[model samples]
Target: MSKSVLVVLSEYGYWAEELVGPLEALDEAGYRVDFATPTGKRPVPIGVSLDPEYVDPPLGRSVTTAEMADKGRRLDASSRLDDPINLAAWLPDRPYRSEPDFLRRQEEYFRALAAELSKADRYDALLIVGGSGPIVDLANNGRLHELILHFYRTGKPIAAECYGVACLAFARDQENRRSIIDGKHVTGHCIEYDYKDGTGFEGTDFVIGPPPYPLEYILRDATGPDGAYIGNFGRETSVIVDYPFITGRSTPDSRLTGDKLVEVLDKGLRTWGFVPRTGVVAPEPAAAGDR
Candidate 1:
């Protein structure tokens, strides 16, 4: 069976390059990829390529626009910014009340995730792409926790980038165990970037948490003091791995993040029941003394 992958996104929009880039990579690699959003609607890019804050006025903006236009023009041209997916199309939604927008949105994503999980036998991996929207849609949602737990329990390769890491904090095992990422080496959008401008507009408009929301601050609390990890020194850091979980800080790491994700997925596939028919294979033990 062709390897199938589920790509989860935040419905709001921003940082289109982050998810689009990795998605194109996966598509090119011949993987079957599907999209799901908090509301099961077509996800939108969080900001315009030309948004002043989105990129440096001159260099960053033009460069980013060209890159996204070249890579994600389909996503760009798609008119339905709020396109909806049938969250009920997935099984998990059957158990939830569907009135509150937030609850329904959360259930849509979790149900999509559950649907993906139900296909474990047919799929090879799952990738969760992070963006500004996840802070609002993905984190702190019970549905997200349900989906994360499903992936964690199945021991599949899970990749999260940028705000994508927030979902990990929500996942707990059957015993109510926290996700493995809670105490593992991981990084995401740096706190410096959050406060470098000394303005909280970013958080106010994009993210999920109480007042004074910050990814780093939440991670610290989630880790519960002395968790093994380090991050955000002078320069930016992107991409972090803690066993089954793979995370990336932001867009710069998208390519490498996708590559590493494929690696992990390949490993999982091999561990399950896949065997490569071609490519270099470990030589069967030669004569006992051939070494």
Candidate 2:
């Protein structure tokens, strides 16, 4: 039987191509992909063909019209969340959103999701697809931390793209702290792109660009030592591979990111000689430091 791959989404309306691009690749590789969200129902791909501007440039050349047509059909069909496994139950409402507080809730959510993952023995890897909505869900949700922890512990490959990488924020190490992303190489929507076009939709100062709200800066701040030179950051070109965890900058990097994820899963499964349990050591922290 083909290996099972779990794909998680935040909301119904995300960039359609991000999920579709990778799903197609994994499917072609003989992997059975199961979609999930905070709720088990079908998620809405926020950016669809209706917006010509957001159509991925690469899709024009590599993605066929027939494929997109099928995707549109499937997308339309997923509106009701037919069989969702509720993510809300697994995750906690922020204890204090005002204080950047999600500690207690995350612990609760993570444990529940971890339990579910343990029962899904068929899955060999976890793929977190990204879209604009991640800013609203995947980035800081504690339950996602639990999800990441379970997969990471089980020696399964944990892959994400664009904002999906934000899920890494809540991931804890042996010391039970944040996983640092500095010097390890990572990418996502840049501050410039967010501010350039995402402001009105995301709201003023909603993003981390312009003068420091961009994800890069946020990640930089979150990872490096206190007062570390945040200005000396790079790794911004996307395509950061740390093994067991693969991340991309934006939608454009989805194909490569997905392909890499498959490669890692294939290798990880083959190397273990058996499925790895939860809590397997992932790639060494991007940098060894307090998170």
Candidate 3:
């Protein structure tokens, strides 16, 4: 049976390579990919991600190659992103405590959520694309939090790249309010990658100078004392697979992240990107064209 993946993207803006990389990998693996957005809007790639001449500040090089830029533009123009699943309508929202009949509404909310989550069974994996857009839409999104929690609880592979990884840290059990990745190895956008200025997403009038928050710090804390956040600093790219969760560090790790997720599905890969479960410092795996 061909496996299917439920991919969640930010409507405001998603990094071009972040989607193209993993998407191509998944397509090559013959997996059916479905897309979902917070409000069912067509997601657009950030302008910089499609600009081949735009050099990445931290990397000091052009991360988007001409070929990759074309691919990104083609993908954006295609019908793949059309009619994305509307998360707001598909998932149930928790009731406010002050609402009338709060107790009954709360119970109903949970029941409805259980039913909606059952839809996750249709997918073998879930992916959250990364970009500055996620900070505005995907992060701290209650509906998305529930969906991520559902995928984790079911043992389905959950893949997140860049800022999308923030959703994983935010998706915690209501009772404990602890991060779902509380004791799981993961990686995300490090502090150094924060843009010095003009950090913006689509459908926005203004840009937040630098990322509003540091994802590295949040991941470090979310991992708790036992679980470690592997920044893999100085590496060309970073992709870590710790059981059902596979995380990528940034734009460069996009395709690699998709490849690791495929390994987790096809080869039952459970652990990687760590030295004997240590915090990090793993060697970079050779990419397809590297050799």
Which prediction has the highest lDDT against the true structure? 3
Q: By descending TM-score, how would the candidates be arranged?
A: 3, 1, 2
Note each model's CA RMSD in angstroms. Answer: 10.1, 9.2, 1.4
lDDT per residue for candidate 3 within 174-227, as digits (tens), equals 899999898889999998888888798888787878898899999999999889
Write down the TM-score of every candidate. 0.69, 0.67, 0.97
lDDT comparison, 2 vs 3, better candidate: 3
Local distance difference test, each candidate: 0.57, 0.58, 0.90
Which tens-of-lDDT digit does each residue in 1-291 have in candidate 1? Answer: 557877777666646677776776687778887666665767666555324345532223332556455555567676533454433345354233544676667657555665565754455566777665676667766555666666667776787777677778666663556655665556666565453332211224533323246777666666554343334333333555555777676666666567667766655422111112221122322221111
In angstroms, the error of model 3 at 271 is 0.4
In angstroms, what RMSD does candidate 2 have relative to the true structure?
9.2
Error of 3 at 23 (Å): 0.5
